[model samples]
Target: MTETHATLPPGAPAFPPGRYGRRREPRRRRPLLTTLLVVALVAVMTLVSVRLYRQYGDPNYDAQVITYTGITDSQVLVDFRVNVPEGGSAVCLLRARDRDGAEVAREEVTVTARPDQRQVTTQHRLATTARPFIGEVVRCRPPA
Candidate 1:
Protein backbone atom coordinates (compact mmCIF):
# COMPACT_ATOMS: atom_id res chain seq x y z
CA MET A 1 0.00 0.00 0.00
CA THR A 2 2.86 2.40 0.74
CA GLU A 3 4.45 1.65 -2.62
CA THR A 4 1.16 2.37 -4.44
CA HIS A 5 0.84 5.78 -2.76
CA ALA A 6 4.46 6.75 -2.27
CA THR A 7 4.09 10.08 -4.17
CA LEU A 8 1.60 11.49 -1.56
CA PRO A 9 2.86 13.11 1.65
CA PRO A 10 1.96 11.69 5.02
CA GLY A 11 -1.46 12.90 6.32
CA ALA A 12 -2.47 14.00 2.81
CA PRO A 13 -5.86 12.69 1.78
CA ALA A 14 -5.62 10.26 -1.10
CA PHE A 15 -8.30 9.33 -3.62
CA PRO A 16 -9.09 5.74 -4.42
CA PRO A 17 -7.17 4.43 -7.41
CA GLY A 18 -9.06 4.68 -10.77
CA ARG A 19 -11.84 6.68 -9.04
CA TYR A 20 -11.24 9.62 -11.42
CA GLY A 21 -10.25 9.94 -15.08
CA ARG A 22 -6.61 10.22 -16.11
CA ARG A 23 -5.04 13.67 -16.05
CA ARG A 24 -4.32 15.28 -19.39
CA GLU A 25 -0.89 16.43 -20.57
CA PRO A 26 -0.21 20.15 -20.86
CA ARG A 27 -1.18 21.56 -24.25
CA ARG A 28 1.78 22.27 -26.57
CA ARG A 29 2.43 25.87 -27.51
CA ARG A 30 1.57 26.58 -31.16
CA PRO A 31 4.14 29.21 -32.03
CA LEU A 32 3.29 29.16 -35.71
CA LEU A 33 -0.38 29.88 -35.10
CA THR A 34 0.49 32.67 -32.65
CA THR A 35 2.88 34.21 -35.19
CA LEU A 36 0.31 34.00 -37.95
CA LEU A 37 -2.34 35.69 -35.77
CA VAL A 38 0.04 38.52 -34.92
CA VAL A 39 0.90 39.00 -38.55
CA ALA A 40 -2.77 39.13 -39.51
CA LEU A 41 -3.51 41.70 -36.80
CA VAL A 42 -0.66 43.90 -37.97
CA ALA A 43 -1.83 43.65 -41.55
CA VAL A 44 -5.34 44.67 -40.53
CA MET A 45 -4.04 47.65 -38.56
CA THR A 46 -1.86 48.73 -41.46
CA LEU A 47 -4.76 48.55 -43.85
CA VAL A 48 -6.99 50.65 -41.56
CA SER A 49 -4.26 53.23 -41.06
CA VAL A 50 -3.64 53.53 -44.78
CA ARG A 51 -7.31 53.96 -45.49
CA LEU A 52 -7.71 56.69 -42.86
CA TYR A 53 -4.67 58.54 -44.16
CA ARG A 54 -5.92 58.47 -47.71
CA GLN A 55 -9.32 59.71 -46.61
CA TYR A 56 -8.22 62.61 -44.40
CA GLY A 57 -4.46 63.11 -44.52
CA ASP A 58 -3.25 65.74 -46.95
CA PRO A 59 0.03 67.52 -47.62
CA ASN A 60 -1.16 69.95 -50.25
CA TYR A 61 -3.29 72.17 -48.10
CA ASP A 62 -1.54 73.81 -45.19
CA ALA A 63 -2.58 76.81 -43.16
CA GLN A 64 -1.12 79.15 -40.55
CA VAL A 65 -2.60 81.79 -38.31
CA ILE A 66 -0.92 85.14 -38.90
CA THR A 67 -2.66 87.12 -36.20
CA TYR A 68 -5.76 87.39 -34.10
CA THR A 69 -7.01 90.82 -33.20
CA GLY A 70 -10.16 92.83 -32.53
CA ILE A 71 -11.20 90.50 -29.76
CA THR A 72 -14.40 91.43 -27.99
CA ASP A 73 -17.18 89.85 -26.04
CA SER A 74 -18.98 89.04 -29.26
CA GLN A 75 -16.38 88.28 -31.88
CA VAL A 76 -12.74 88.07 -32.96
CA LEU A 77 -10.91 88.75 -36.21
CA VAL A 78 -8.48 86.03 -37.24
CA ASP A 79 -6.03 86.56 -40.08
CA PHE A 80 -4.56 83.42 -41.61
CA ARG A 81 -2.70 82.12 -44.63
CA VAL A 82 -3.35 78.97 -46.56
CA ASN A 83 -1.21 77.16 -49.09
CA VAL A 84 -3.12 75.36 -51.78
CA PRO A 85 -2.37 73.92 -55.14
CA GLU A 86 -2.02 76.60 -57.74
CA GLY A 87 -5.52 77.70 -58.73
CA GLY A 88 -7.03 75.29 -56.22
CA SER A 89 -9.22 76.14 -53.29
CA ALA A 90 -9.32 74.80 -49.76
CA VAL A 91 -11.39 75.07 -46.63
CA CYS A 92 -9.67 75.77 -43.34
CA LEU A 93 -10.95 75.16 -39.86
CA LEU A 94 -10.52 77.95 -37.31
CA ARG A 95 -11.01 77.86 -33.61
CA ALA A 96 -11.11 80.30 -30.75
CA ARG A 97 -10.47 79.36 -27.18
CA ASP A 98 -11.09 81.06 -23.88
CA ARG A 99 -8.52 81.66 -21.14
CA ASP A 100 -9.40 78.30 -19.64
CA GLY A 101 -8.87 76.53 -22.98
CA ALA A 102 -12.53 75.99 -23.68
CA GLU A 103 -13.68 76.33 -27.24
CA VAL A 104 -15.54 79.59 -27.64
CA ALA A 105 -16.07 79.48 -31.38
CA ARG A 106 -15.28 77.42 -34.46
CA GLU A 107 -15.82 78.07 -38.13
CA GLU A 108 -14.63 77.01 -41.55
CA VAL A 109 -13.14 79.54 -43.90
CA THR A 110 -12.61 78.88 -47.60
CA VAL A 111 -9.68 80.24 -49.56
CA THR A 112 -8.78 80.06 -53.20
CA ALA A 113 -5.38 80.30 -54.84
CA ARG A 114 -4.94 82.21 -58.09
CA PRO A 115 -3.53 80.57 -61.15
CA ASP A 116 -0.05 81.74 -60.33
CA GLN A 117 -0.39 81.75 -56.57
CA ARG A 118 -0.05 78.94 -54.06
CA GLN A 119 -0.60 80.90 -50.89
CA VAL A 120 -3.64 82.97 -49.96
CA THR A 121 -4.00 85.23 -46.98
CA THR A 122 -7.46 85.89 -45.65
CA GLN A 123 -9.34 86.84 -42.54
CA HIS A 124 -12.65 85.93 -40.97
CA ARG A 125 -14.73 87.49 -38.25
CA LEU A 126 -15.72 84.64 -35.98
CA ALA A 127 -18.75 85.23 -33.80
CA THR A 128 -18.38 83.96 -30.28
CA THR A 129 -20.58 83.47 -27.27
CA ALA A 130 -17.95 84.88 -24.93
CA ARG A 131 -14.67 86.75 -25.09
CA PRO A 132 -12.01 84.88 -27.07
CA PHE A 133 -8.60 84.48 -25.50
CA ILE A 134 -6.87 83.35 -28.69
CA GLY A 135 -7.53 82.24 -32.21
CA GLU A 136 -5.96 79.44 -34.21
CA VAL A 137 -5.95 77.87 -37.63
CA VAL A 138 -6.51 74.20 -37.03
CA ARG A 139 -5.96 72.71 -40.52
CA CYS A 140 -6.65 73.13 -44.22
CA ARG A 141 -7.94 70.65 -46.73
CA PRO A 142 -9.31 70.65 -50.25
CA PRO A 143 -12.94 71.51 -50.50
CA ALA A 144 -15.28 68.56 -50.48
Candidate 2:
Protein backbone atom coordinates (compact mmCIF):
# COMPACT_ATOMS: atom_id res chain seq x y z
CA MET A 1 0.00 0.00 0.00
CA THR A 2 1.19 3.57 -0.84
CA GLU A 3 0.82 6.48 1.63
CA THR A 4 -0.89 9.71 0.39
CA HIS A 5 0.06 13.32 1.54
CA ALA A 6 -2.02 16.52 1.28
CA THR A 7 -0.65 19.32 -0.88
CA LEU A 8 -1.27 23.10 -0.78
CA PRO A 9 -2.22 25.25 -3.75
CA PRO A 10 0.53 27.22 -5.40
CA GLY A 11 -0.75 30.70 -4.24
CA ALA A 12 -2.04 29.56 -0.77
CA PRO A 13 -0.14 29.74 2.52
CA ALA A 14 1.64 26.69 3.79
CA PHE A 15 -0.10 26.95 7.30
CA PRO A 16 -3.22 28.94 8.32
CA PRO A 17 -2.66 32.01 10.52
CA GLY A 18 -4.84 32.88 13.60
CA ARG A 19 -6.69 36.20 13.93
CA TYR A 20 -5.91 36.65 17.71
CA GLY A 21 -3.06 36.04 20.18
CA ARG A 22 -2.38 36.35 23.90
CA ARG A 23 -2.50 40.00 25.05
CA ARG A 24 -1.82 41.77 28.40
CA GLU A 25 -4.07 44.57 29.76
CA PRO A 26 -2.64 47.99 30.53
CA ARG A 27 -1.59 48.59 34.20
CA ARG A 28 -3.38 51.42 36.06
CA ARG A 29 -1.44 53.64 38.47
CA ARG A 30 -3.13 55.67 41.24
CA PRO A 31 -2.45 59.40 41.25
CA LEU A 32 -0.15 60.51 44.07
CA LEU A 33 -2.16 63.71 44.77
CA THR A 34 -5.46 61.86 44.99
CA THR A 35 -4.05 59.29 47.41
CA LEU A 36 -2.58 61.99 49.62
CA LEU A 37 -5.87 63.93 49.58
CA VAL A 38 -7.87 60.87 50.61
CA VAL A 39 -5.47 60.12 53.45
CA ALA A 40 -5.64 63.72 54.70
CA LEU A 41 -9.44 63.71 54.59
CA VAL A 42 -9.64 60.51 56.63
CA ALA A 43 -7.22 61.85 59.22
CA VAL A 44 -9.11 65.14 59.56
CA MET A 45 -12.43 63.34 59.90
CA THR A 46 -11.04 61.08 62.61
CA LEU A 47 -9.71 64.04 64.58
CA VAL A 48 -13.02 65.91 64.25
CA SER A 49 -14.98 62.84 65.42
CA VAL A 50 -12.78 62.45 68.47
CA ARG A 51 -13.00 66.15 69.33
CA LEU A 52 -16.78 66.17 68.97
CA TYR A 53 -17.13 63.12 71.20
CA ARG A 54 -14.99 64.67 73.88
CA GLN A 55 -16.79 67.98 73.71
CA TYR A 56 -20.47 67.03 73.49
CA GLY A 57 -20.94 63.25 73.39
CA ASP A 58 -20.31 62.45 77.04
CA PRO A 59 -23.32 62.22 79.41
CA ASN A 60 -22.05 64.38 82.22
CA TYR A 61 -24.98 66.72 82.74
CA ASP A 62 -27.36 69.01 80.89
CA ALA A 63 -29.60 71.96 81.75
CA GLN A 64 -32.42 73.69 79.91
CA VAL A 65 -34.40 76.78 80.80
CA ILE A 66 -38.10 76.09 81.19
CA THR A 67 -39.51 79.49 82.12
CA TYR A 68 -38.72 82.75 83.82
CA THR A 69 -40.78 85.55 85.34
CA GLY A 70 -39.76 88.85 86.78
CA ILE A 71 -40.76 89.03 90.40
CA THR A 72 -39.38 92.50 91.17
CA ASP A 73 -37.05 95.09 89.60
CA SER A 74 -34.03 93.24 91.01
CA GLN A 75 -35.50 89.76 91.45
CA VAL A 76 -36.52 86.99 89.00
CA LEU A 77 -37.88 83.47 89.33
CA VAL A 78 -36.51 80.90 86.95
CA ASP A 79 -37.72 77.38 86.35
CA PHE A 80 -35.22 75.04 84.72
CA ARG A 81 -34.72 71.38 83.92
CA VAL A 82 -31.64 69.42 84.92
CA ASN A 83 -30.47 66.00 83.79
CA VAL A 84 -27.80 63.91 85.42
CA PRO A 85 -26.81 60.32 86.10
CA GLU A 86 -28.66 58.21 88.64
CA GLY A 87 -27.86 59.39 92.17
CA GLY A 88 -25.56 61.98 90.74
CA SER A 89 -25.17 65.57 91.80
CA ALA A 90 -24.50 68.45 89.43
CA VAL A 91 -23.57 72.11 89.71
CA CYS A 92 -25.35 74.50 87.41
CA LEU A 93 -24.62 78.11 86.59
CA LEU A 94 -27.59 80.43 86.18
CA ARG A 95 -27.33 83.87 84.74
CA ALA A 96 -29.65 86.85 84.38
CA ARG A 97 -28.78 89.21 81.56
CA ASP A 98 -30.01 92.71 81.08
CA ARG A 99 -31.19 94.19 77.82
CA ASP A 100 -27.66 95.37 77.05
CA GLY A 101 -26.32 91.75 77.14
CA ALA A 102 -24.51 92.38 80.42
CA GLU A 103 -24.68 89.72 83.09
CA VAL A 104 -26.54 91.44 85.88
CA ALA A 105 -26.63 88.39 88.12
CA ARG A 106 -24.95 85.00 88.30
CA GLU A 107 -25.40 82.15 90.71
CA GLU A 108 -24.43 78.50 91.03
CA VAL A 109 -26.77 75.89 92.39
CA THR A 110 -26.23 72.26 93.34
CA VAL A 111 -28.79 69.74 92.14
CA THR A 112 -29.07 66.19 93.37
CA ALA A 113 -30.31 63.29 91.29
CA ARG A 114 -33.09 61.16 92.72
CA PRO A 115 -32.77 57.41 92.92
CA ASP A 116 -35.56 56.92 90.40
CA GLN A 117 -35.13 59.91 88.18
CA ARG A 118 -32.56 61.28 85.74
CA GLN A 119 -34.27 64.60 85.12
CA VAL A 120 -35.34 67.19 87.70
CA THR A 121 -37.24 70.42 87.36
CA THR A 122 -36.76 73.12 89.93
CA GLN A 123 -37.24 76.81 90.50
CA HIS A 124 -34.80 79.33 91.88
CA ARG A 125 -34.81 83.04 92.58
CA LEU A 126 -32.10 85.28 91.21
CA ALA A 127 -31.27 88.72 92.67
CA THR A 128 -29.72 91.00 90.14
CA THR A 129 -27.97 94.36 90.54
CA ALA A 130 -30.13 95.73 87.73
CA ARG A 131 -33.29 94.76 85.93
CA PRO A 132 -32.83 91.66 83.70
CA PHE A 133 -34.70 90.91 80.54
CA ILE A 134 -33.71 87.27 80.21
CA GLY A 135 -32.74 84.44 82.50
CA GLU A 136 -31.05 81.24 81.33
CA VAL A 137 -28.86 78.38 82.37
CA VAL A 138 -25.26 78.86 81.34
CA ARG A 139 -23.91 75.36 81.97
CA CYS A 140 -24.23 72.29 84.14
CA ARG A 141 -21.70 69.65 85.09
CA PRO A 142 -21.28 66.83 87.54
CA PRO A 143 -20.10 68.13 90.88
CA ALA A 144 -16.50 67.27 91.62
Candidate 3:
Protein backbone atom coordinates (compact mmCIF):
# COMPACT_ATOMS: atom_id res chain seq x y z
CA MET A 1 0.00 0.00 0.00
CA THR A 2 1.19 3.62 -0.85
CA GLU A 3 0.58 6.86 1.18
CA THR A 4 -0.99 10.06 -0.50
CA HIS A 5 -0.59 13.76 0.68
CA ALA A 6 -3.55 16.13 1.04
CA THR A 7 -4.09 18.74 -1.73
CA LEU A 8 -3.59 22.53 -1.06
CA PRO A 9 -6.25 25.16 -1.98
CA PRO A 10 -5.95 27.46 -5.08
CA GLY A 11 -3.58 30.48 -4.90
CA ALA A 12 -1.78 28.88 -1.89
CA PRO A 13 1.92 28.08 -2.09
CA ALA A 14 2.84 24.45 -1.55
CA PHE A 15 5.21 23.81 1.38
CA PRO A 16 8.70 22.91 0.25
CA PRO A 17 9.72 19.47 1.21
CA GLY A 18 12.67 20.73 3.22
CA ARG A 19 13.61 22.72 6.35
CA TYR A 20 11.39 25.79 7.16
CA GLY A 21 12.42 29.29 8.38
CA ARG A 22 10.38 31.91 10.30
CA ARG A 23 9.31 35.18 8.61
CA ARG A 24 9.85 38.63 10.23
CA GLU A 25 7.54 41.69 10.01
CA PRO A 26 8.61 45.26 9.19
CA ARG A 27 9.97 47.46 12.03
CA ARG A 28 7.78 50.22 13.54
CA ARG A 29 8.91 53.89 13.92
CA ARG A 30 8.76 55.86 17.24
CA PRO A 31 7.74 59.62 17.38
CA LEU A 32 8.10 60.24 21.15
CA LEU A 33 11.80 61.26 21.01
CA THR A 34 11.29 63.91 18.29
CA THR A 35 8.34 65.54 20.08
CA LEU A 36 10.29 65.85 23.36
CA LEU A 37 13.24 67.57 21.64
CA VAL A 38 11.07 70.35 20.14
CA VAL A 39 9.44 71.17 23.50
CA ALA A 40 12.83 71.47 25.21
CA LEU A 41 14.16 73.93 22.60
CA VAL A 42 11.17 76.30 23.01
CA ALA A 43 11.59 76.49 26.80
CA VAL A 44 15.26 77.43 26.51
CA MET A 45 14.60 80.28 24.04
CA THR A 46 11.91 81.86 26.26
CA LEU A 47 14.25 82.08 29.25
CA VAL A 48 16.99 83.79 27.20
CA SER A 49 14.63 86.52 25.88
CA VAL A 50 13.34 87.41 29.37
CA ARG A 51 16.86 87.87 30.69
CA LEU A 52 17.89 90.19 27.85
CA TYR A 53 14.83 92.46 28.21
CA ARG A 54 15.49 93.05 31.90
CA GLN A 55 19.05 94.15 31.27
CA TYR A 56 18.78 96.87 28.57
CA GLY A 57 15.28 98.39 28.80
CA ASP A 58 15.19 99.29 32.48
CA PRO A 59 14.29 102.98 33.17
CA ASN A 60 15.97 105.37 35.62
CA TYR A 61 14.70 108.82 36.66
CA ASP A 62 16.18 111.76 38.59
CA ALA A 63 14.21 114.78 39.85
CA GLN A 64 15.61 118.11 41.02
CA VAL A 65 14.03 121.30 42.26
CA ILE A 66 14.53 124.12 39.75
CA THR A 67 12.83 127.04 41.46
CA TYR A 68 10.18 127.82 44.07
CA THR A 69 8.69 131.27 43.48
CA GLY A 70 5.58 132.61 45.13
CA ILE A 71 2.44 133.37 43.11
CA THR A 72 -0.52 135.64 43.81
CA ASP A 73 -3.39 134.54 46.07
CA SER A 74 -0.84 132.56 48.15
CA GLN A 75 -0.05 130.13 45.26
CA VAL A 76 3.53 128.95 44.67
CA LEU A 77 5.15 128.25 41.27
CA VAL A 78 7.17 125.06 41.79
CA ASP A 79 9.50 124.25 38.91
CA PHE A 80 11.18 120.82 38.63
CA ARG A 81 13.63 119.09 36.31
CA VAL A 82 12.86 115.45 35.63
CA ASN A 83 15.70 113.60 33.94
CA VAL A 84 14.93 110.28 32.24
CA PRO A 85 16.94 107.98 30.05
CA GLU A 86 17.78 109.42 26.62
CA GLY A 87 15.03 108.95 23.99
CA GLY A 88 12.40 108.24 26.67
CA SER A 89 9.44 110.40 27.75
CA ALA A 90 8.06 111.09 31.22
CA VAL A 91 4.56 111.90 32.51
CA CYS A 92 4.55 114.11 35.58
CA LEU A 93 1.61 114.59 37.96
CA LEU A 94 1.72 117.33 40.56
CA ARG A 95 -0.53 116.95 43.58
CA ALA A 96 -1.26 119.19 46.57
CA ARG A 97 -2.77 117.60 49.64
CA ASP A 98 -3.99 119.02 52.97
CA ARG A 99 -3.24 117.72 56.46
CA ASP A 100 -6.09 115.22 56.16
CA GLY A 101 -4.57 113.65 52.94
CA ALA A 102 -7.34 115.01 50.74
CA GLU A 103 -6.33 116.10 47.23
CA VAL A 104 -6.58 119.90 46.90
CA ALA A 105 -5.12 120.46 43.44
CA ARG A 106 -3.59 118.30 40.66
CA GLU A 107 -1.82 118.92 37.34
CA GLU A 108 -0.49 116.64 34.57
CA VAL A 109 2.48 117.39 32.30
CA THR A 110 4.34 115.50 29.57
CA VAL A 111 8.10 115.70 29.13
CA THR A 112 9.64 114.74 25.79
CA ALA A 113 13.12 113.55 24.83
CA ARG A 114 15.74 116.05 25.99
CA PRO A 115 19.08 115.18 27.44
CA ASP A 116 19.40 118.43 29.42
CA GLN A 117 16.10 120.27 29.87
CA ARG A 118 13.38 121.02 32.39
CA GLN A 119 10.17 118.92 32.39
CA VAL A 120 7.53 120.41 34.70
CA THR A 121 6.52 123.88 35.94
CA THR A 122 3.54 123.46 38.25
CA GLN A 123 1.60 125.86 40.50
CA HIS A 124 -0.23 125.05 43.69
CA ARG A 125 -2.59 127.44 45.47
CA LEU A 126 -2.43 127.20 49.25
CA ALA A 127 -5.59 127.87 51.22
CA THR A 128 -5.22 131.21 53.00
CA THR A 129 -7.29 130.21 56.02
CA ALA A 130 -7.97 126.47 56.05
CA ARG A 131 -4.86 124.20 55.99
CA PRO A 132 -1.26 124.12 54.83
CA PHE A 133 -0.65 122.25 51.55
CA ILE A 134 1.92 119.51 50.94
CA GLY A 135 3.17 119.05 47.35
CA GLU A 136 4.24 115.80 45.64
CA VAL A 137 5.77 115.11 42.22
CA VAL A 138 5.03 111.73 40.63
CA ARG A 139 6.72 110.77 37.36
CA CYS A 140 6.14 107.76 35.11
CA ARG A 141 6.24 106.58 31.52
CA PRO A 142 3.16 106.65 29.31
CA PRO A 143 1.52 103.35 28.28
CA ALA A 144 2.19 102.18 24.76
Candidate 4:
Protein backbone atom coordinates (compact mmCIF):
# COMPACT_ATOMS: atom_id res chain seq x y z
CA MET A 1 0.00 0.00 0.00
CA THR A 2 2.91 2.33 0.67
CA GLU A 3 6.65 2.56 0.17
CA THR A 4 9.47 4.92 1.19
CA HIS A 5 11.39 6.92 -1.41
CA ALA A 6 14.61 4.98 -0.64
CA THR A 7 12.88 1.67 -1.38
CA LEU A 8 11.25 2.74 -4.70
CA PRO A 9 12.82 1.74 -8.02
CA PRO A 10 14.19 4.54 -10.26
CA GLY A 11 11.28 4.37 -12.65
CA ALA A 12 8.58 3.73 -10.08
CA PRO A 13 5.59 6.00 -10.31
CA ALA A 14 5.40 8.53 -7.44
CA PHE A 15 2.45 9.97 -5.57
CA PRO A 16 1.60 13.69 -5.64
CA PRO A 17 4.08 15.91 -3.80
CA GLY A 18 1.79 16.60 -0.76
CA ARG A 19 -0.38 13.45 -1.06
CA TYR A 20 1.54 11.56 1.58
CA GLY A 21 4.11 12.90 4.10
CA ARG A 22 7.67 14.27 4.00
CA ARG A 23 10.60 11.96 4.73
CA ARG A 24 12.37 12.84 8.01
CA GLU A 25 16.14 13.04 8.32
CA PRO A 26 17.96 9.94 9.51
CA ARG A 27 18.88 9.70 13.24
CA ARG A 28 22.50 10.46 14.11
CA ARG A 29 24.62 8.07 16.20
CA ARG A 30 26.05 9.27 19.52
CA PRO A 31 29.31 7.41 20.05
CA LEU A 32 30.27 9.47 23.08
CA LEU A 33 27.02 8.74 24.92
CA THR A 34 27.29 5.03 24.18
CA THR A 35 30.92 4.96 25.33
CA LEU A 36 30.04 6.73 28.57
CA LEU A 37 27.18 4.32 29.29
CA VAL A 38 29.43 1.30 28.64
CA VAL A 39 32.14 2.68 30.96
CA ALA A 40 29.63 3.38 33.73
CA LEU A 41 28.17 -0.12 33.46
CA VAL A 42 31.63 -1.71 33.69
CA ALA A 43 32.52 0.41 36.72
CA VAL A 44 29.34 -0.52 38.58
CA MET A 45 29.80 -4.22 37.81
CA THR A 46 33.42 -4.11 39.00
CA LEU A 47 32.39 -2.46 42.25
CA VAL A 48 29.68 -5.07 42.90
CA SER A 49 32.09 -7.94 42.12
CA VAL A 50 34.65 -6.54 44.55
CA ARG A 51 32.03 -6.11 47.27
CA LEU A 52 30.76 -9.67 46.84
CA TYR A 53 34.29 -11.10 46.79
CA ARG A 54 35.11 -9.40 50.08
CA GLN A 55 31.92 -10.65 51.69
CA TYR A 56 31.71 -14.24 50.42
CA GLY A 57 34.76 -15.23 48.36
CA ASP A 58 37.60 -15.31 50.90
CA PRO A 59 40.21 -17.90 49.99
CA ASN A 60 41.36 -18.38 53.59
CA TYR A 61 38.05 -19.89 54.68
CA ASP A 62 36.87 -22.82 52.61
CA ALA A 63 34.41 -25.63 53.22
CA GLN A 64 33.72 -29.02 51.63
CA VAL A 65 30.98 -31.53 52.22
CA ILE A 66 32.34 -34.80 53.60
CA THR A 67 29.12 -36.78 53.58
CA TYR A 68 25.38 -36.45 53.55
CA THR A 69 23.06 -38.84 55.30
CA GLY A 70 19.79 -39.20 57.16
CA ILE A 71 17.73 -37.96 54.23
CA THR A 72 14.01 -37.95 54.91
CA ASP A 73 10.84 -36.13 54.02
CA SER A 74 11.47 -33.45 56.61
CA GLN A 75 15.21 -33.19 57.08
CA VAL A 76 18.76 -34.15 56.04
CA LEU A 77 22.06 -34.51 57.85
CA VAL A 78 25.06 -32.67 56.38
CA ASP A 79 28.63 -33.50 57.37
CA PHE A 80 31.22 -30.96 56.29
CA ARG A 81 34.83 -29.90 56.88
CA VAL A 82 35.94 -26.27 56.85
CA ASN A 83 39.41 -24.76 56.92
CA VAL A 84 39.87 -21.36 58.51
CA PRO A 85 42.71 -19.32 59.92
CA GLU A 86 44.40 -20.96 62.89
CA GLY A 87 42.39 -20.15 66.00
CA GLY A 88 39.91 -18.18 63.85
CA SER A 89 36.25 -18.59 63.09
CA ALA A 90 34.05 -18.64 59.98
CA VAL A 91 30.40 -18.73 58.95
CA CYS A 92 29.46 -21.27 56.31
CA LEU A 93 26.49 -21.66 53.96
CA LEU A 94 24.76 -25.04 53.91
CA ARG A 95 22.35 -26.13 51.23
CA ALA A 96 20.07 -29.07 50.57
CA ARG A 97 18.56 -30.04 47.26
CA ASP A 98 15.84 -32.39 46.20
CA ARG A 99 16.19 -35.12 43.56
CA ASP A 100 15.07 -32.69 40.85
CA GLY A 101 17.86 -30.27 41.76
CA ALA A 102 15.58 -27.82 43.48
CA GLU A 103 16.84 -26.20 46.63
CA VAL A 104 15.01 -27.61 49.61
CA ALA A 105 16.71 -25.80 52.48
CA ARG A 106 19.53 -23.39 53.28
CA GLU A 107 21.15 -22.22 56.49
CA GLU A 108 24.28 -20.57 57.88
CA VAL A 109 26.46 -22.30 60.45
CA THR A 110 29.37 -20.91 62.40
CA VAL A 111 32.62 -22.84 62.94
CA THR A 112 35.72 -22.05 64.97
CA ALA A 113 39.29 -23.34 64.90
CA ARG A 114 41.34 -24.25 67.96
CA PRO A 115 44.58 -22.49 68.89
CA ASP A 116 46.69 -24.77 66.72
CA GLN A 117 43.98 -26.13 64.44
CA ARG A 118 43.11 -24.80 60.96
CA GLN A 119 40.53 -27.43 60.04
CA VAL A 120 37.17 -27.96 61.67
CA THR A 121 34.64 -30.68 60.97
CA THR A 122 30.99 -30.58 61.94
CA GLN A 123 27.55 -31.85 61.07
CA HIS A 124 24.14 -30.21 60.94
CA ARG A 125 20.56 -31.38 60.55
CA LEU A 126 18.66 -29.18 58.07
CA ALA A 127 14.89 -29.19 58.16
CA THR A 128 13.34 -29.05 54.72
CA THR A 129 9.91 -28.75 53.19
CA ALA A 130 10.44 -31.73 50.88
CA ARG A 131 12.56 -34.87 50.67
CA PRO A 132 16.19 -33.95 50.05
CA PHE A 133 18.52 -36.01 47.87
CA ILE A 134 21.79 -34.31 48.77
CA GLY A 135 23.30 -31.83 51.21
CA GLU A 136 26.35 -29.67 50.73
CA VAL A 137 28.51 -26.86 52.06
CA VAL A 138 28.20 -23.90 49.70
CA ARG A 139 31.00 -21.73 51.06
CA CYS A 140 32.69 -20.39 54.18
CA ARG A 141 33.51 -16.82 54.97
CA PRO A 142 34.77 -14.69 57.85
CA PRO A 143 32.22 -14.15 60.57
CA ALA A 144 30.37 -10.87 60.26
Top-lDDT candidate index: 4
TM-score per candidate = 0.68, 0.61, 0.40, 0.64
| Cα misplacement distance, residue 102 of candidate 2 (Å) | 1.3
Models sorted by TM-score, best on top: 1, 4, 2, 3
Question: Would you list the clashing residue pairs of candidate 3?
Answer: none
Clash count in backbone of candidate 1 = 0
The parts of candidate 2 lying over 4 Å away from their true place are 1-60
What local lDDT does model 3 show for residue 84? 67
Please give the ranking of all candidate structures by lDDT, highest first, separated by commas: 4, 1, 2, 3
lDDT (C-alpha) at residue 66 in model 3: 62
Clashes of each: 0, 0, 0, 0
Model 1, 1-144: lDDT tens digits are 332567888986677767665646989999999999999999999999999986677778878789999999989999998889999999889999999999999998888888999889998999998999999988888889
Tens-place lDDT per residue, model 2, 28-76, is 8779978999999999999999998856655658788999996567988
| 1 or 4, greater by lDDT | 4
Please give the lDDT score at residue 116 for candidate 4. 100
Locate the minimum summed-lDDT window of 10 residues in model 4: 15-24
Model 4, 7-116: lDDT tens digits are 78999767756676886698999999999999999999999999998877777898889999999999999999998999999999899999999999999999988999
